[model samples]
Target: MNRDAAPWREDFRGGSREAEDRLFRAMAQAISPRPAARPDAAPVGTDRADRRLFHAKTAVGITDAALMVDRALPAGLVVGHFRPGAILPAAIRFSNASAIPQADGVPDMRGLAMRLAIPAGGPHDFVLANFPTALARNAEQFLALAMAAAGDWETRLARLASRIGLWESRRILAHLKASLKLCPSLAHEHFWSASPYLWGSRPVRFELRPVAGEPPPPILPAPGDNALRIEFASRIARRSVTYRLALQHYCDERRTPIEDAAVDWRPRAARPIEIATLVIPRQDISGREGRWALEQIDRLRFNPWNAPEDFRPLGSLNRLRRFFYAAGDQ
Candidate 1:
């Protein structure tokens, strides 16, 4: 295999890869740490899945707009209750995904998880990721990668594996390629819901594509690691920025596979349909306000499974994720 190229890079050009559910589950059972409480006692906790620490995180208002589903879709185990022209209010939080909470230049992933803030009901949390696609193929691979990052002997072993030709090393390489992105400003980066989620009954994916503004010039000096955060703060303080909330429906098992999270939708032919518009208004997040924002969100659970009955997250990776971050009373 070419050292610079991945053998499975073109794998998604075919159809969906069949998942080994039992294999993933068994591995999870063996490696999954025993929670402080029993699985039934408390399914989920305030503890994050992997990205355990963050900064420059804040909530922004989502306009009360209609989410027009382009096609006829169902609810219940899907984008539940969401249809063409259904009015809703939403909010988003921007954060750095670092378990050890390192500096900005340290190669890591950033995230933007949104949630519907309804007046009389619960919220549907949405994790819009910075990566175009996930670094692992299935639940088993995903778990291995998380364990490696979770810190401890596992992390050491994972790093050692990367130096050798091991399966875990492949995942590390994928993580490096997918997560180490050029992010000078939030307005320039396109965020994705890398894993597949139920769009009504059909399995589909979501993306937050930047609709305006060009990337900061490459010749600009590196203003330190928190440059993206500083730019984001400055952007919001000056004016609102927009990102097209779009969806990609399943076309085939290969091109739009439900199980594999490692491949992006190849050939950017049809731009995804714009379902809703995310307008992030300018605001201040310094001093007490920033601290308060962090405190409030840090206490709340922000898993992708924090959605409604209609929008059930699918695939093995999500299943394992749900296992790690369920929201039972603690």
Candidate 2:
């Protein structure tokens, strides 16, 4: 084990896993009163159709991609499916991080969930967002936020203030506001894991960045509700989309705490190093293969824990996510 990771390991071992699980389960329940059901086959835009409490917006696109590890990667950085020159099949899903489907022009967080299929075990999944940091620092705070999210905007703010105090609630709201960006295209945005994960015994963060030198597509002056989807599909139809898969190694507990995810570990203590390439070839997502891919995504659970032991997620929030995702899967 990496000696530098001892503090986080000890902290994780000291926590009450059972208690955390119960808390997350309660969070899941409070977020969505409806019992968890199988992924619905209903079409997008169906009112309150999605069973997920968060990121309920239907996927814009689900397509086949390829992850090619850099051939010149250092031997020490090569582990699991990170072998040099290896090309792994990947499933990529793009969507809005909103329970209510809204116009693409509206400010909201974006999501990218990628699942890479390896030969050894279950597929490894990376659930990422455009934001580099999360609003809540721990499971308890996240539960409070979840409870607040179950209501309308006013109700959410009032509930949050009541649960976590006025000042803290306002601070979280400010974070939320800043995080909700209005990116013109999903293909042009950068996505981050936002939480630390084990990278061959070392805690690291992951990111997906658009390949350099590619000009972003033009944006609509007045975007429609499905504007983002339209822009992404138009881009895919014209040419392939490529991203550099990068990693940010942990510096220390102070700068890269494994437990606090709200901290952005960039321009401070760590720098991102490109390790692999992700290519989404030009394709017609409305075709038969595209339809099949979309169906598969609907039935899938894009949990960060759907990974090998070496890549297990770290932090209290991630631990809570395990149970929260499990509860949603029920």
Candidate 3:
């Protein structure tokens, strides 16, 4: 990792230290979510209503005979079931981040949720990500913002400004400006977990980026409500998609805080060390196998907290997620 001074290190105190553990749990429970229909149920987010989801229970594993390079990770950071060379069965779900479902052409945060069953038949490892590698707000801040969206957009922004400050409001607006922009295709877009996590015991973050030198996808029809999903599924039907799963360690507290969910580490610290790959093969969702897969995806929960002990999610955002995620269990 780069030894150069990271100017953002001073802000690295937001992750675990942001709140007392119990307090975060209390805050999550205070929301008073309805009892989940299932043991592992949880909400996708504060933003609910008029939402649309396009899902596929595709398999995931490391690339076939691909090179495995380690970044000198400590044993604690090797994450038991997710070591550099491990591979397992996995499923994925894709959706748009909006309280009200909008057209795929509409600008909105895009999401990718994946669930990988452990080798020993333990709890599935779930990793949720956004197209942008960074988040605009932290735990409490984001919850407040999403809640406000239930009302009018103007009201949401104004209320958020009053709660978090005008400067933050502007910063968030700018961040979303880029984050919500339409992507060429879901298969072509890169995804990030955004929040940091414990790589075993060490602090680090992970992301899945498209591998280079692949054939460029063909252009599709004009913008429509479910355009992204349609195009993604169509492309997959023709060929498989692959992404590199890489991890970046925390060099220093200031450079890479473990508690803050809003801070973007590795911006100046160092590049991610490629550890594994994710390959999603083509499938016809209209067929019997596809229908069975979709049913499975809908029945289970997809939360970052679903991982094993070594891969536990870190930071305040994760803490806040404790209750809401379980609430979605069904």
Cα-based lDDT for every prediction: 0.57, 0.76, 0.59
| Ranked by lDDT, top first | 2, 3, 1
Looking at model 2, the pairs that clash are: none
Say which prediction, candidate 2 or candidate 3, comes out ahead on lDDT. 2
Best-to-worst TM-score order: 2, 3, 1
Model 2 over residues 24-85: C-alpha lDDT tens digits? 55555665565422222212221322456567664565657999999998776788888989
TM-score of each: 0.72, 0.87, 0.77
Q: Which is better, 1 or 2, measured by lDDT? A: 2
lDDT of 3 by residue, 132-185 (tens): 344444567756664565467668878888878889888877777877766567
Model 3 alpha-carbon drift over 4 Å, by segment:
1-22, 29-77, 131-137, 218-222
User: Backbone collision count in every prediction?
Assistant: 13, 0, 20
**Candidate 2 segments exceeding 4 Å error:** 3-7, 10-14, 26-49, 219-222
